[model samples]
Every structure is written in structure tokens, then in C-alpha cells.
Target: MHLISYITSRSQISEKSIQNTIELLNEDCTIPFISRYRKEKTGNLDEIEIGQIVQLKEQFEALEKRKVSVLKILEEQNVLTSDLKQKIDKTDDLTTLEDIYLPYKKKRKTKAETARKNGLEPLAKMIMSQRINDLDYTASKYTSNEVESSEKALEGARFIIAEWINERTDIRNNIRYQLERFATISTKIIKSKKEDEKAQKFKDYFDWSENLSRIPSHRLLAILRAESEDFIRVKIEIDNERALQKMEDRIIRSQNKCAEQIELAVADAYKRLLYPSLSNEALSIAKEKADEAAIGVFTKNLQQLLLGAPLGEKRILAIDPGFRSGCKIVCLNEQGDLLHNETIFPHPPQNRDTDAIKKISSLSDAYKIEAIAIGNGTASRETEQLIKRIHFKNEIEVFVVSEAGASIYSASKIARDEFPDYDVTVRGSVSIGRRLADPLAELVKIDAKSIGVGQYQHDVDQSKLKKSLDATVEHCVNKVGVNINTASASLLSYVSGIGPKLAENIVTYRNENGSFSDRKTIKKVARLGGKAFEQSAGFLRIKNGDNPLDDSAVHPEQYPLVKKIAKDVGKNISDLIGNSSELKQIDLNKYITDTVGLPTLKDIISELEKPGLDPRKKAKAFSFNQNIKSITDLHEGQLLPGIVNNITNFGCFVDVGIKESGLVHVSNLANTFVKDVNEHVALHQQVIVKVLEIDVNRKRIQLSMNYK
Candidate 1:
């Protein structure tokens, strides 16, 4: 029951590392902070390893709490023997603990309980003992007003024995193991719902069977979802004969009359009690594993989407495209503040291309727009085409940004607070433009699940999904290093250790006292104490600050060390900032104190080399086939340029400038065998794909990358 011991047994990480991570987490240190700052304490564990330790710690705490409740229950029932208590105390797993407590748990009215109430316990005990000499007489003696005949008494006794056999820890554990190892999960279409159109999407799973242990996460989740919708029936099957034989071998000791009775009880136990429980338990465990895998995929995709190429502080004209309603357009300044807004109809019901082109050209010249961001939604391709045809005064780069969660952000409370006077359309247009300018800053305002970068996202554990996505956002934000003076409260909140309250307070402090010129001013924010400042100072950047290190990833605590290095080298801190030649002259070993190791020193030197450098790539203009505007325009074997919009365990979905995205299955990702989809494709990655098939009836387009 020791927490560290249990965690060490389950994870390959060292016990000391886990212990240190647990202590840091208990002290309210965040995963990013500990992973970045407390490397010496955690043996240089990354954020993922630290996160695993945190999850395991919570799991062990839950197990211990359950154990305490079980002990109290056993004590009140007068069955808490010293040996039993010791066994329960020694067990660490929840399943094993529950198994030990099963026999002592109170139950409602059942055949076994009724027989026990009628005083058939001794006959049940005789059958369990496998003594045949007086088994019939013992059963007959138990026949009372409730039990009329010896056969009836024996039947009741066998029922009691059946319950006893089911409660045996060895029998339950063995059956659970067999189920986990060899169970086959099969699905069938509900006969009544076979003609249901809604069920056709899951048609691939209508007659599917796969080993439960080997089923991939995406397929398993799909089957389970289909079962949940009642369009399909799912079952977990194992060899019943083998399971029964195993049960008999575990319980039957000899071939006597009592043994024969026990054999009958074992059959009832396997068929009625043990099989169902084990099947459900095994499936539940498998489903949890599948959930974890799906969540991992979701977190990775969210991270990639958030960190996608940034166009960086440009004057952008963003458009939310439409056909029936005119395209909603907004011009954003370099800081993403809305400067102008209007609507233009260049398509459909009223084709006002001339006026639209004139207005767009005038606006681009007036606002000095550098890039054009068009939403990849309805009429997007048409909008891009119309914009291209415009004879603008200046050369403007056009980029089609994914509008997956733009509506969600527009209708959010955050959006309302940021733009109380603006409607959803204006806010949505602003979001599209800001996404092209800086994706991480704008995307953090929306819920990660609504971003449409995941598979089975809504079907997984929501709380777990949120936790993982939040951690990923934090990692990305800290890795990129937020600008303290200009970052929104939403972006600030994800920086290493700053929560919502502190972020709000920091923004308020900035509003009252003007922009932060140095890292020390952050401590002056209301309710932001020493610990918060320590964890957050490194990730918050202050451009053109009094201290040059404020804009870099180097922690403020290391400022003194850098100063010493500067003094030792006979140069000012500013002189050594970007002077790589001078930085190379000083030995790093000399700066490595007991508190700071070579790793921290090396990172400090690297940061000093390129202070405040952005890690994200620059956004570039991508074009779909000019001739292809919708699914109707697609043809088999036609090579087209597309962006990878979503990735899953099975494959990646590519946007080919159509209403329906084309699927490039994992097998089609490369000419050779592709094992991992992420290895070959990423979110927002531009690539050329060939149309393999287009199903107009289902609106599904299959694409391949193997075409020349």
C-alpha cells in the first residue's frame, strides 16, 4: 500500500524521481515549471513523465481511500481478522482490493442469501469440504418448512455453494486473466435498425469481430459508440468450455458425491456469475486503455494546431466566407484590434463582384493590409478566387485559415468581454485574422475539444481530455514564451504557473500602471506572490525592457549569474547578449553552481545567443487546385494540393478545397509501409494528394500520396 512502491512497480521511472515529483506536485508546482526549472530535483524528467507521476499519485490516493472504507466495513461486519486485514493492507491494486472484500460485502435478497437464512450453511460447508459420506443426510436435516424435500434442500445448498465459488479470489482472478488475454469482441447490426440510415456510417462495424486485446483504439471506440447508439449489438466472447474446465479444476478436489455437487455449483458460478462479471471488468479496463490512447492523439493534434505556422503581427484582412449571406470581412491592425468591418457579396444570389472587388481594393490600400485570411468554410474557394481576381493597389498575400472553432470563440464569454459592441460575425472575422497572425494566442480562447483536430474526442472521458489539453496548451505557451505586455489574459493564464485569477490581476495591474518594462514589475501584480512570480517570470517576455534578459527564456534568478559571467569577461551584459564569439570564450563549467547544473547553463547560453527567437514557422500561402472548388470538381487520379487538417490513429484528413475533406488512410501516406501517421503527416502540413475515389452518394473522398 506504499504509494512510491506501487508507482515504481507500475512505471519504469525510478522511485526517487517519482518521490521528488510527488513532493513538487504537493507543493503546488506545475508540470511545466517543475519540468523546466526543477530538473535537478526530478532527475531531468520531461513534462510528460512528470504528468504521469501526478496521475499515478492521484490513482494511488483513490485506492488508499477505498481500502480505508473497506476496512471499516469489514470491521463493523465482525469479519476483520488479523490475517485478512494484513492481506487487504498489502494489496495495492483496486481490482485486487475489491476482490478481497467481495465475500464480506453485504448483499440484497438472493437465492444464496435465502438459503443461508433457512440454515442450509452446514450442508454448503459439507459440499465445499468435499466429504461425501454424510452429504445427503446433512442436506436432509436442513429441510424445514421452507424446504420440503432433500433434493430442494440440496438445490438450495448448491446455490449457496455457487455464490461461494464465485467469491473465490483465485477463481475470479483466473477468469479475469483469461478474459483479458483471449476475449473476442464482436458486433452485429440490430435487425430492426438494419435499414436505419443513421446506422450506415457505422456499416463497417456491423459484422466486425476482433480480439479485444489487439483492437486498435480508434476502431474500439467506434464500435463502442455504435453499440451505445443501439444500432449494433456488441458482445465479448471467450471459450466457455475452457472457462468451465478451469473453474472445475480450481474447485473440484476429488470425485465424490460432495465433489459432484460442487461441480454443479461451479457450472452455475461460471455461467451465471463469474463470466459476466469478468467480461464486463475486462472490457472496462480495455476501454480505459482505449480512452488514454485517444486522449493522447487528441492532445498531440491540439498541440500541433495551436503551434501551427504564425504570420506574426501583420495587418490582415480576414473573411468569414458564405454564399447565401455575404462574406463577413474585417481589417485587423498589427495587434489584432478590429479597425474596420463590412460585408461583401461576391457569390450566389447577388453576384456583386465589381463592387466587392472595388471595396476590397480600397480597404487594402487604406489599411495597408499585408496578408488576406479567408475562412475555409462554405464558399471559401469562391471567395479566394474572387479575391485573386481583384486588381488591388498593393501586393497582398492570401492565406486560407481553418475556421474549425471560430464560431465557438465568437460566441464565447471571452469574445463578448473582448468585444462587447461587436456581433458574432465581426468577432469571428477578427478570430480568423488573429489566428493567421498568431495561432497560439487566438486558439487558446476557444475550448480545445471544439477545434476539430481529434477523433472520438467527445466520446472519451471529458475531464481527462480537458486536463490533457490544458497541459498541452500550457506546454506550448511556455515553450513559445508569451509577451507579458501584449498577451491576452487567456494566453497569459496558460504560461507556466499563472492561473486565471493571477492572469486577470496581472492584466489589471498593467492597465493601471502601464506596460511592464521589466520582469520585476510582475511581482507588483495583485495576489501574485513570490512562488507565482518564480514559476511565471521566465515564460513572460518584455520587449525593449530595462533588462535585456527579460525578453529571453533565461530565468530572472539566473540574471545575477549572467551578470557575473559578463563581469568576468570584461564586458557589459548588453555587449554579451548576442556576441556568440564572446560567449564561447567563457567555460560553462565555471558557471555551474551546486544549484544550477550544466543543463541550465547550456540553456542560458543558447537563449543568450538568439534572445527572444520564435520557434514557430512563418505562415505561407497555400493554394488548392484552381479548377476544383467542391466535391463535384474532384476526379479520380487528379493530383491536388491540400493541407492536412486533422490526423488520427488510422489516417489523416486533407482539405482539398471542398465541402467534404478527403481521407488519406495510413496505407496511402507513403510509398513504403507507414506505421505511424504522425510521422508522415501533421496538422496544417501542405502536401499533394491524388484522388483515389470519390463517392458522391456518401460524400466521401479517398486520397492517396503515392501518385507521381
Candidate 2:
């Protein structure tokens, strides 16, 4: 078996689970398909674990291909010997194999290789052995070719052995292990003796440090950025004595006069060739770890964002805010159905005028609009003012909704299909409105990154960012159930079993046949399989249906057991469910076997409480001052307030009612140094800021927590 397959088996997980995960993540299958339809085959492994497995599997395949390529190259050069072949086969690591191949590998001309090719191999070997019994005698065996003297002769021979020892696979591996074991990661800043007052961006990270294990991903990435811009210098090192001792023991196993030669060669090799290569290798390892950690942090932040709050199944009046352009208003019914739409300009020309009041009042009166959702973009506060001018009821709340990428979604093909008759601009406004009522449903229409919840989002690796955001969206969608018949392709794609294409198929099929009354009717959609149906059916609910259990997460497989338990309680499944006392007495283990476990049983019991319930609810809405128009509005020491647009590495980006956001630098977080940006602030958190600087010409704004 291959090493990966062997490792997987050693983990005690079933071979089928491993195989299914690999196949689903292979080039042929997409994440949405694998996550939704292949749960049973993968033993319900989620998208995150499934994605990790795919990456590892690819790495394994690449390593295997590389080994063969290396072996083939070595054979072609006519230097492939039995002992070399043995070492290659025994080698299980890429670094080790590459190290062994270093000497024979084709490269540019080096001093030692040149010397060996010119018939000085014997002289070099004698000095490398370090046996003093024939020191001058061994040196005398070779006459100088390029070098003219005894000192030069010894130097050339020493150079040859130094190169050889440097390239040794075992020796290099030993040094790498020792360095990693005792390494003290050091970071320093080469200050200018005076700070760069002109370049204020990098003043915070001038001096920073943390261990490899303890350093936060964002902090490490920040330091790297600072170094890249020539703002600071960073170095990682280990104890030289500890490393040297380990190197001696590892390389000089024989402990003869040859030991001295080995030590000299090892030290020279490390300082010259080995350090450069291993330094890069070690840093790469560090970055990989940082990437993993960053991805993890992003995952948690996204989860909290995703799980934030859903207004759920509410009738909403959404307004896409604009100034010179009139507000785009759409009234969505209780089921998120767009009941009515209109353009109302209650600002400037007709501020509180009778005509404006009549138009706004008529629309609100017609639909009995329960709530108003104002897009938190340009002119949002003005629009909110318009809504407040003519009051409706005390109970009706006005929310300042984040319309980050609402326009992007509205202009999309998916949005067009949903509102083909309406203009894209109008559709955008409608989306802004609906987002307040249900974030999951509306946000799904836009790419997660466009929602703007991350830091250094555009700078980091794009592919990695996209993959992480997509996975987060998928997880969130699965957690909250989707309506089988009414959910749009954008929203449906997020469901456990449905992907973008399949979601479109389901919607198209529904549009052709009319709305589906039951979950079983979903089978007619193209490309959907039995496995997909089994995993997704329970999560998709029908409000008014013949099967009451359709609204719960309880799988159809457990339908019979639920019925049996209901029978024992002298009631039906529909009634016996939802009551905690009735479910508490049921003998769960009697139904338990290999397939069904306590996890599934408990999940079913929770779903029974509120069938087809949305886990999100809206937080209390508050609209800040309308006067804070732009970054130019602020002055030094001014106590201006803002909402945390995003939390990033260096600091937090705040939306202080401006087109361009302002940054509160990391050092300005408090009197003491701040290690992590997330520790001080979070996404969408409203905060107080002291305007530290404002460069309106360049649109560069800076704020601080400490005011002088």
C-alpha cells in the first residue's frame, strides 16, 4: 500500500471512508456535490475535512511522481548503483530524496565538482578521512594542477570534501532536525535611528517577536509584509552549540580521526550550501503552518458571521439607498416574496413634502410593511431619515443593513432569472431589503469575499481565499435548512446536497412544473442522485405538508423508529415528537446498530423542537450620526464613532460613514502592544475612534484609541 493509504488505515478509519473522500475531491467532483450527496460514503465527513484530504492526496501523488522522475534521471546519467538504489527505495520523504540526489543532480559549475573532474579525487578523499598517520604522505600522493603550492593543494582538497559533506542526505537531514528542535525564532527591526514620519503605515511593526508555535497567523503574515516593504528585518535561529553537538553525533558515528573531517565538512556545508536551502525550507514550513492557522481563524470568524442572526420569515420593506438617485424600495411578503416595488425620493427636493409623504405612505399602507431595511451604503442614513419622517407604528424597526455586495448579486445571471422582468438596479435594491430579513438567503447570491468580512483579503493567495470562503458558505447553508420549493438557485446551492448547477436544475424544474408540495418531488431535478436525496431531503422543509416530519432534520431512515416510539407512547410520530418528556423516555439504544449512532439520534430530537426552524435572528438595529460623511469630516483628537467593517492583521478597518474606510493601527489599539487584531475587535462591531490623521488628498485616514 502507498504511504498515505497506509497512514489512513493506521488512523483506524474505514478504507471506504478514505477512498470516497479522495474520489469526491478528485478533479471529477466538486465540493458542493461531495458535501451534499456523498455523506454516507464518506461517513458524513464535512467539506473542511474533505478539502484537507484532497490537498494531502494531491501532495502524495506529486511526491510519488517526483520520486520516479528523480530515479529516472539518475539512471539516465549511468550513475545508478545498488547502494544508491537501496537508499532511494528506503527514503519516504521528498526532502531526504532530493538531498541524496544533490551531488549527482545536474547544476551550474562549482569549485569542488571542477576539482574532482580534474583528477584530484584521491587528494580530496585523503584530507576528508583526516587520519594523521599519513597526513603529508597522503597530500604528497597528488600534485597540483590549478593550485601552485601545498597550502593551495590542501585548500582545494578541503573544498571538495566540504561540498561532498554539504550535499550528504543523512548529514543534511540530521542538521535540519536539530535546528527545528532547538530553534529560537528571532525578529528584529533595523530602525532608522529616527522614525519615518512620512511613511506612517509601518511604524507599528518596527519591533516584534513571538515563538514559531505561539505566533498568531495574522501577526506572522503582518511581519512578512513589513519585511517585504523594507520596513523591518526578521530572522529565525536555534542554539548553535546544541545543533553542533547533535550534528557531531549524527554524522561522526564511527568516532575516528575521520570524525574531525566530518565535523569540518558538516560545519562548512551548513554555513555555505545547507543553510540557504534549509533556511528556505524551514521558512516554507512556517508559512504553511501560518496559512493553516489563518484559514482556521477565518473559519471561526465566518461561522460566527454566518450564524449571526436571521430575521426569518418576515415581511420586509427593503430600500437600496441613493442620494441624487431615488431610493429603490421593494416590499417582500412574509415568505420573502417581493409583493411590491417603487422609487421614492424623500430627500433634498421633496424633504417632508406632502407629495413625498403621500407616495411613501401609500406604498407602506398598501403592503402593511412590518419593517424597513435600509442598505448601509451611500445615502443610507438619509434614506432612513425619510422613513422616520412619517411614522408607521412603534413596533416597526428600521435596520441599517450591510449591502456590501448586494449590487454584484443583483447584476448576476442568477438574480436575473429570479427577477427577469425587473431591471438589475431594481433587483439590487430588492436584495438589499431582503438581506436584512434573511442574511443567509440574500448573501448566498454574492461571493463571500465580496461581503467584506476579512483582512488583507485581496493581498493573500487568491485561490486559497476563494476555497476557504466557499467552504464557509457551504457549512453555513447546511447548518440552516433551505425551503425545498421556494429557495432560489443562489440559496439552494448552499444546501447540504445541492450545488450551483443542481440548484439551478431544481429551480428550473420547479419553474416548469410549478411549486413542489413534498420533498420527494425533488427527485425529478436533473443530475440529482439517490445519495443526494437521502442526505438533503430531511433538511428541506414544506410548511404545509402531509408528512409533518419533513420539516425536521430526522432522516427518513429513522422514520420507522420514530413511528415505533410513537406507538409505544400511545401516540403518533407527529405528536410524540416536539415534546421533550415523550422523547426522553424512548429507548434509543434499542434502535442503535452500526449505521445509526447517538449523534444522529440527538440531532433528530433537537430538530423535533421547532421543525424547519431558522437558527438566526436580527440584533437590535441602530443608525449612527448622518453627518459623518467622509474621512475628510474628521480632525486630530476628534472622538468620531464608527462600525468595524473588518478585522485584519495590522489593525481594524472601520466604516465611519465614509466611501473609503479608515484604519486604526495595531499599536493604537491600547497603551500596551496588541498581538492579534481579532483579540481587540471583531467584524461588524461598532466602536469609538480618535482621529489621529487624515490625508484626504490620498484618501488615507488614520484613527487611534489613545487621544493626546
Candidate 3:
């Protein structure tokens, strides 16, 4: 199939747009760069549209490659025909291509191959033709020393007929239709492991049954996980009689004894060959859908978490709260540099509250701290209460930060490189402080899966998950342009064209020389070629730089256009920066060129309006109900404040200032029927939930948002 036309049909994108996107991708342009910079070329397609085009293009190319391999194999076997070659060349679907190649595909020794070796091919053909009146005589004619008897000859003929029926494209398609529409997935408990302690967690799926087409992605993943763990036996079923009847209708033409033999062959084909292969295919397709849905959810959650409000360059005193180990404390400067570090046991076995208060107060006073970030881990509630009771020298805003992947970041080599002399505790404490200051920058150092924001992360396809998460991080990083001087290597790596090596090189250059004064100096970095600069320069910002436009989202190549626009307005570039009145007066139509269109001109105008502005909001302090400490303290009908920490298809998990986060089921999200969990809530959204139920033994708290 034609690659561009196939992609257009699949993505519903214009042919021209798909063609342009493919060309740009072939030229090594990234999705973000092509979408943002080449809008005129792609007809103003956004990142998502461009991403679809890229995925579909890759799929089509893979299909074409497979067709070439299959054609070569067919030619080598001396079985290729003009019509067969045309069919394979015209088909774009992988399944259809495989179906066409099935009869020619080489296989291991089977009943059909063995029967053919025993000289039963002519007898099988006679049985398939259904014109013979005396089947026993025809079968007897084929009997030999290898066949032994007419009965064995008949059996061998049926086996060859069964293989032919299995290879027929129309018969296979009929069975696939039955499976796609009517398949039901059911599971039964493995009796031996029903009472196993580890198996109890998957008890819900032990005896579950659902239509495969309508089963929720999360539910299917859970069931599959249970089966993988040997806790349950899963089966995919459909109307077998209906499938066989359709196959028989397509193959048997006469009502003679020959037809009877063909019927037996159809039954054998349905049972021994077709059902097993197609049932597995049906399950595999369902699993691919489930994986896609799960990966999409993860991508959205990671995006929200990464784009979460930043506490932007504040002097922070962060605490990684603990009980027996004492809370590790680290003081961070506005640039997220570690200035001081210590430990404070404000709670339990070493209940040195007074000394802890003294040390905290002195540290706050000495570091000129503007905020206090308490980790929402062990003893987090008590720590927050303790910090609130202290009379600080300054009016410090206390915030409770989620410490999801702080430990992972602490033990990582990235952390070791950042702080070579510090222990894990100190590194973890520093991570907490850095996260509070800039969540996206610090969170980038840790893997997205370790951030505790996704559902069934480990159970999905790891390669697809990594690709999606990496793409999300790259989009968010480019969405909010990176600071050339202040950004960490982890954060810089996600910028448009800068991978890990280039990021390290940029950092080393920054360390050896002074900070970058303009975007042009980025070319001086080793191994950063012109193409990399073209893709990355627009996303890297230099604050207090030589040129005012360098800090904006406008690309370096567009500098002359921006200067020309500024000159046309009779104002200098600095005077025109952030001067919306002057920008709006100029007619954007006047500057349209062959390479520069209204889209690029409009984007430049908008960037000039809010030059170097962060798309994310500033972080604010949140307070949990002081009276509620743990799950036991929660009572039905009591209202409490909470933050949405994780979301799934079923519901969102809300942290209610307790050890156990509460579940607000999708039904309870609102009085109306909620189709999507994200429609009513988002990651890190603060809301008040009414406690509906509590199970202290299981440590479960049920909450409801449908309150007056």
C-alpha cells in the first residue's frame, strides 16, 4: 500500500499534512519541533496530530517491510503468482497480510504434511470436490503399504482437507467475525491457591466473567495479572457451533457422501487448528487495546504531575518525616542548592520536641527560609502539626509535599552525581526540598513509573510505556521552556533535540565556562550540531541574556523576523518586548512570507506579549484537617479536605491527611453519571470530601464528593 495514503486514511489527516509530516520526520525533526516550528508546512497540526501521523507512518512502514519479506519467501519457494503478489502488495492490515501468506507459510511436521507424504493428496482433492458417489472405493484406491487400509486412508484424506479448510481466507474471516462480536472472557479460581494469602488480593477476579469487547481496561489488566500469578484460569469463549456452521456453509456444496467427509474435515479444522489460533488472536487484540488505554491514562497522569504548579525558586526547609529514624532535614537556596542538612526527631522514641523546635527555628532564621515543605510520608501529619505550633522568626508558609519517588531519586546515580558526599537520607531530603521548589525539574531525575501516579504501570508493555512517558516529559519540558543556566541535566535532556549525552555536554560546558548569556552561544557545546540547535534553541531560555528575545519561546532563526517586526513598529526590540499595545497594532498579514506564515507570525506576537512566562501556576500552601490523623479518626459523614494523588478508571484516590488514602468512587464523584474520572477531578486538585465509610482493619476509607 502507498504509505502516505494509508496514513491519511488511518489518521484522518489531510494527505498533504501527512506527506509533509513524514518528510519532516525523515529529515530527523522531532514531533515537538515539527509541530511548533513547521506549522505552515504541516497545515497547523498540533503535537497530538503530528504524533498520530508519526505512529501511523511507522506502522505502515513495518507492514511494507513484512510484505517484502513475505514476497521474497514466496518467490524462493516457486509459489508466487501475479495475483497473489498484487493481493499482498495492496493489503495494509498486518492480519490480512498474514492471512494471505498462511497457505504458503512453512510449518513443522503436522498431520496434514504426514498425510500428503503418504500419497493421500488426490483422495483429499476428490473428497473436497464433493462429486464422488463411492467414497470408500475412492479411498481404497489411495491405500498403500503406508496407508494400510481404506479407513486409515479416509482419516488421512480428512486431515489434508482440514488443513485446506483452515488455510481458506473466507473461512478464517468468518471465524474472526464470530470471535470479535461474541467473545466472552471468564476466569475460575485455581482451587489450590484460592486460600493462599498472596492470592487474596486478586480474589475479585477469581470467579469473574465479562464480555471481552466491553470489559474495562483496568479490569482486564487485573484479571490478566491474576492469571499470570497462577491464581486463576482464564478462558476466551464464543459460540463454537455458530462458527463451525458458517465455515461448513462456505465449504460444503453437495449432499453426497463426499459432503459428509468435508463436514468431518470442517469440524476437525474448527477444533484442532482454527479455534486455538483465532482465540489467541482475539485475546491478543483485546490485550493490545487494554495496554493502549492503560498507557494513555499513564501518559495523562505523568503530564499533569510534571506540569504541576512550581513553588518557584524559594528558600525551603524540607523534612523527610519518619518515626524511628527521625525526620531528615535539608535547607535549600532559591536555586535548589543544598545549604545545610541535619536530622530532627520531633516524634516518638526520641521525642525531642523542644530541641527539634529550637533547631528548626534556628535553621529557618539562619537560612532566611520562606517556606517549610514537610514530606507526606511516615509521621507527616504529626510533623505538620509540630511545625505549625512553632513560632518562627519569619512568616513561613508551611506546605506538605508528596514524597512519591524521593527515595528512588536519592538512590539513583543522578543523585550521587549531584551530591557526591551525601548519604541517601541527605539526598532524599534535598530531593524533597528541590521538588517543592520545582516539581518538574526535580521529578525528571526519577523514572515516571516510580512516581506512584499510574495504575498497573508494571503490568503494561514496558517499551510502549517508556516511549509514551518519555514523549510526555519531552512535551512538558518544551511546553515550559528550560532555563539554560539553572536547569538540571535531567530536565534539559527532555528539551526538543537534547538527549542525555547532549544534556551532559551542555552542563559540562556551563560548568567549565560561565553561564550562557545568549541562545547563540549554545552552538559552542561539543557534538551539538546545527540540526540539534534548530530543534532545541526555541525551547531553551536564557534569563538576563544579551538579547531580550533569547529568553522567549521564539526560535533563533526567527530573530531577524522579530527584529523586522519591531523595526516596522518604530520601536527597539527591548521597547517592544511585553508591549502588547504596539504588537496588536501591527498587521500580521504584512509579514507573511514563503517560509513564514500567519501561524508563525501569530505565535511570535503572542510570545512577545508574555515573554518567558511560565504556563504553570504558582504553588500554594494546603492544609489538611488537623483533627484527623489516621484512618481510625475518620467517621462517616464527616467532611475533610483532601488532595487527589492518583486516578484510575474506577475512581480517584484522595489523601486525607492520614496513613490510608480514601477512595472516591466514580459514581460518588457527582450526582450525574460520570463517564470519565478525569472530567470531575485532576491530579493535585484540592477538594473537600465527605467520609462515607471506613474499614479500620483493612485500612480503607471511602469518600464522596457529592455533598451540599
lDDT of each structure?
0.91, 0.71, 0.92
Kindly list the per-residue Cα lDDT of model 2 for residues 198-274, writing each as its tens digit: 43465566765556555656776777777776767877676666666766676565555456556776676667787
Worst 10 residues of 3 by lDDT: 3-12
Which candidate leads the pack in lDDT? 3
| TM match of model 3 to true structure | 0.98
lDDT of 1 by residue, 1-708 (tens): 688998898898998898888899888888888988888788889988988888888898999999999999999999999999999889888888998998888888889999989888888987888866877777788888999989989899989999998899998988888888899999999999998999988989989999999999999999999999999999999998998898898878888888888888888888888888889998898889999999999988999988899999899999999988999999999999999999999898999988999999999999999999999988899999999898777789999999989999999999999999999999999999999999999999999989999889988989988988998999999999999999999999998779898999989999999999999989999999998998899999999999999999999988999999999999999989999898877799987777898778888889998998999899999988889877898889898999999999889999988889999998888889888889898899999999999998789999998775
- Residue-wise lDDT of candidate 3 within 242-329, one digit each (tens)? 8888888898899999888889999999999999999999999998999999998888889889999999989999999998999999
> How many pairs collide in each candidate, listed in order?
0, 6, 0
Q: Give residue 470's lDDT in candidate 3 (0 to 100).
A: 94
My TM-score estimates for the predictions, one after another, are 0.98, 0.77, 0.98
Model 3 residue pairs with clashes:
none
For candidate 2, give the lDDT. Answer: 0.71
Model 3 per-residue lDDT at 705: 97
What lDDT does model 3 reach?
0.92
